[model samples]
Target: MSSSPFPDTDLAGNDARVGDGRNLDSILRIPVLMQVVLGSATMPVADLMKLGRGAVVPLDHRVGEPVDVMVNGRVIARGEIVIVEEDNSRFGVSLTEVVGPSAADQNT
Candidate 1:
């Protein structure tokens, strides 16, 4: 196997492998909440309370705009909404951009 710049290591600085040895199977099994945010809007409490059936609240995003794909409340990527080919009744997100977390992202 080719040498790696950063070999996988566990908490104790041991190799993280699956050669019937130590691994991170449990860690990988942990679940995280994923959300697709189309857009958001801000309104006063009075206006929000006034909202009823058939009322439309406009969002900041326009049609064909990329939606934010969030994981555990963090924006991880941006993608456009798509219709599932196998199931026309379902909707999916086609990831276009993979966001790398940075200091500036903290505010997002």
Candidate 2:
């Protein structure tokens, strides 16, 4: 009947800040946020269908531009691209900052 003390603050639906290591372990037990990456862009169907091998489909973002970090459609942070390897390997991304919940979404 009453509101939860640590109401879910994560847009990702993950648990809140657990104050201690043991608490943190319990917190870790909770499911992590489900995330998906989307390179921002808008392409018409005709243009989209014209793609071929080696065809360059430009993203709206430029080199060194802060990548949009979204949690459940809300922008939470931004970071730069990192190359973990020069060849074929997963690229790493480093978070430069964490954005707090927007004032418009804050609870009183």
Candidate 3:
């Protein structure tokens, strides 16, 4: 296993993992939010029992508007729906509009 020069110090202490420390830059080259779009939600069991094949569980979004993209329960961005192919589709949220906890996000 790779070891940290500052092994005694934990990540929270410095947010640094050992290596060339320079080689660590490669981690940044990796995609930032890959596969983060998958989602599933659970409501009350009573509600689940009410659902049927044809029933529409209204999503918290409106037509022609960007839907709130969440990850692990935090609202991250807004995006409109897109159909890439006949059998596959996905959302394309603008990175520029990704939401953060405050009025301003560092990404913006």
Q: Write the per-residue lDDT of candidate 2 for residues 72-93, one digit (tens) a residue.
A: 7777877877777765577766
Order the numbered candidates by lDDT, best leading.
1, 2, 3
The lDDT, on a scale of 0 to 1, for candidate 2 is 0.69
Whole-model alpha-carbon lDDT for candidate 3 = 0.58
lDDT of 3 by residue, 2-105 (tens): 48554644555553444648447757677544333433465899999998899866554456655667655567776665665645655344443677675554
Write one digit per residue (lDDT tens) for candidate 1, span 1-60. Answer: 439876676578777766744565866788999999999999999999999999999999
Give the poorly placed runs of model 2, Cα more than 4 Å off.
Answer: 1-27, 33-38, 85-88
Order of the predicted models by TM-score, top scorer first: 1, 2, 3
Candidate 1: segments with Cα more than 4 A from true spot: 1-21, 104-108
TM-scores of the models, in the given order? Answer: 0.75, 0.59, 0.45
Error of 3 at 66 (Å): 1.2
Best by lDDT: 1
List of clashing residue pairs for candidate 3: none
Clashing pairs in 1: none
